[model samples]
Target: MTANPTATEPTLLSLPAPDEWPHWMGARGDAQLAEARRLVDDLKAQRPSEARQVLRVWNDAQTALSNAASIASLFSEVHPDRDVRERAENLMQDVQKLDTDLGLDTELFAVFADLDDTDLDADASRVLEHTLRDFRRSGVDRDEATRARLRELSEQAILLSQEFSKNIREDVRSIRVRPEQLAGMPQDWVEAHPVDEEGLVTVTTDYPDVIPFRTFAHDADARRELVTQFLTIAWPANDAVLQKLFAVRREHASLLGYATWADYDAEVKMIGAGQAIGEFIDRITALSGERAERDKAVLLERLQQDRPDATDIDGADATYYAELVRKEQHAVDAQRVRTYFPFEAVRQGLLDVTGRLFGLEWTPVSQEAAGTWHADVATYDVARDGERIGRIHLDLHPRDGKYKHAAQFDLVRGVRGVQLPEGVLVCNFNRGLMEHDEVVTLFHEFGHLVHHVVGGDQEWVRFSGVATEWDFVEAPSQMLEEWAWDADVLATFARNEAGETIPADLVAAMREADDFGKGYDARTQMFYAALSYDFHVHETPDLTERLRELMGRYSVFPYIAGTHMQCHFGHLDGYSSAYYTYMWSLVIAKDMFSAFDRNDLFDPEVARAYRDKVLAQGGRRDAADLVADFLGRPYTFDAYAAWLAE
Candidate 1:
């Protein structure tokens, strides 16, 4: 690894107390931004012969800036204290402005252009190439006035994104229900929400409250009411925010000589173009067409058993019927499955599974060493061969004002010998027992955690961790989800309070039941992919209307009026027009998993090979090359297609 030349050792990242956040974050961020500017000035004055050294210095400075920004941004999403979260959000905007300014620095671009690419090693060459490309994409080559406008637009984009997410996070709508409305839900779930003085129970749109209610609640009106609230999250307010966001992005793309925001966004991804995303979405939809129809038929038929006069079902009814089908036909009750998976057990089991597969050890980190914003957060140090590799934090339960989804956020990028990688997995699940689907999510996010740790050993920070193509980032995590389904893997950790492992037959039933929803699930994802794509590709005035159109085209369920799903579609902010990346990456994941022997998922030799060939390469190689190296061939869609058909 190349030394930073400016520092002997980089400071490890940690969350400051809420009271100290504003000061610590403000001072650290200011210093890092100033240092980055100073390095750019140094690079501009350096002789061509010193290009390599000066570039390394520049990278070191930017790395520091990135770490500060990332840590603050992560806390902004997951911190329990609202004021602290807001402060962190403001800090994140400052970092985004600095990043935009750096990207648009023509002098820095000129300095890089003067360097000879042949002088650098393979990894460094890739870094230089990507940097130059990014500069061009950032409009560094434009006139001064245009560059200034780009800077303004970039900052606006950041603010708008923050607003969109904040609206969703803050809006937690609820409904009151009678005790009879809780029928069919688990006894524990029912007990958790005791009747109030009015002889009513309150259910909120939080995942823990809403998911089971939608799946198991017998009262159709109660389920539909809750679904309406869930789907309309951040409705009228985000309506305007989203429109402004779209306009700003459209103008940003227009200024950069692209037809649409989607076109501009797709340039850096593996898919290469917006039109190609449409094609991919169409292809997947076709692949799932037969299965989706069959599944929809079964669901519609099941609906008729209760409502014989009903001709169709809405999104609210889909989950209930699907669970009913799983219980009746496949003999797997989701509520019963939750009994085996206690939250704490699943956490340890995940650590054990990954550690055994990758030949690593994990030990708890003291609170003193790993400062946290919340007590619910847990910290660990990951080690391989008795050497500390990275630090990871798990913030894995629901709370008011927390991010409403599960994801892994990188707190620090690991550049070997310079700093240790740090990541936090933020999730919302019940604190006691977890739903089986929640277990899958945990494994999936942990896959990303493992990727960040294993891939952080690269010499250049730019190529470190999950810094690969934006489109390929989800593949490793998606691939890791397979472990959640394997009977042997489940037996290791899934247990009841009575100390009994989950029955193998029950797992088989769960597997069989899982097949029942494939068609509808695939179509649902296609709807999301299409919605994400069309919103950027087509400049429609009515996002709601366009969303409805896409829903009809891609989803099996008809659009439910009065639900503005786009308001709470958070990916429209972060992922922008690249939501198709999920499906694209899944294709690669399935193909790669084909290399593993299903009967022996714990094969050390195969696991080690995957670790070295895929995760360790990081962004040093193209994603295609990385996969080919591990599989001895390029990935194909056959695996995904077969899975969808099954």
Candidate 2:
């Protein structure tokens, strides 16, 4: 793992310095674009006799450009300060335009096209081929006027995507809950939500805030109010923004000779087309749709156990009663289970388990060397057999104006023995001890970081990290969640403040109870997958109505009037045509987990096999080929189907 002189060389595998990432990168964004243009000009100025240096020159420029834009964009999304976010967003627009220009530059593509691939390795050759293909898809082959129009469309897309996501972050609404309404909620949760002078507790739409209130708060009126507000986030304003977004996308797709954005986007996906994605959903729905109805009836019966004359079930009421049924049937206390899984301990346990599985070790960077934007964030260096290989940053708390979900952002892409990749695992877990689901989430996001780091072994920047086909990218992450379910793995760190291990039976019960909502939960995910998938495939004027129709058809609970889940459906912002990627990815994830199922959950042999065949390959191979190599067979849906049935 010593640094390779031909790559970044000399100072490689040094601790990641994300703190070095400019806090307000507005100025840096402009400078980076200027350098990028200069580099591109240099490429054009090079002699025809200089074709030997084309790969090195172009690869270096692309790396610098990507690093700048990614740093700026990531800050724009997650920075705690609004001023920094605004500045970053403003510069990001220009970066996006320059990015488009640089990528679609006919002159640069010609240089790459002129180069002989005979000198390049297989991976570098594949990288160049993909670049050309992407450029063609971007309309590089179009007439001058059409190419110019495509550039305009590309800039508009960058702005609209920014605006659509901004609306989701900036839209503000909160509800006042009466003190009595906090009944049935965990005491810690109750205490966290303090009442103002008016004696009304307040809640916002953040997952930690609203989800707990809905799931455990006994106050029907409070849950109803919170649910309504949560559903309508980015409404009225973003509604039109989304329509415009999709319209532009549809037009963009048409320009590329595709019927819809779904088809246009699926040109490089595992499923191949939106129609195939739809058919997959139809197959699952046919098998599970009736089971969802039965699940709903069971929940309604539980609700009626209290309100004897209850006539209908609202989405808010479903959660309150579902918790009751879980306890009654499976003896699980979702909140009580949190006592065993503190944030710090869970982090340690995750590192330990993954380290043992993959034969790696993690060490925190010295505080002086740990460059961080927020004091809460920390950095760690990953090593294998004493050779530093990668760096990871942890930003695991929620605050006002922060990105509202859990995700891993690749701050730097590494090539083996070259530039060590740096990944930021940003999540919104409770600062307090987390619930088991949050623990699962911690593992899930960590899986992404591992992929970003382990998969960074590739030689080309474009092929580095989690660069697989979009839908299959989540499979490795989801596969890691199985470790969270293992009792032995949890025992490694599932201890309370008192230092007592979580009881084996308690862990067992929570695991069992977590499955109680599977029938309805699977249906809920399917409803979302279909709504997003069907819309992009067949664009229509009445998107809200289409959303309502899908919900009415697939949802376990009846659709509520005046509620608009699509408004908060941020997936539409970027994931529009590919929202089914989650379930689609899970099919492969479940199959991969089968390798470890027959052996020890932490079987090192299986773990190393997964690392070598899947995680380490990145985009070096097609995802199907990787899966086939790992499993020694073509992938199948049998494991996924059985999981759903279970």
Leading candidate by TM-score: 1
lDDT of each: 0.88, 0.80
Global CA lDDT of candidate 1, please? 0.88
TM-score of 2: 0.94
lDDT digits (tens) for residues 42-151 of candidate 1: 66675445556756876786787777687678978987777777778887888888889889988778878878877688877787888889899999999999999999
- Cα lDDT tens digits, model 2, 377-411, are 87889988787778888989887787888889877
TM-score of each: 0.98, 0.94
- Pairs that clash in candidate 1: none
Going through the candidates in the order shown, the clash numbers are: 0, 0
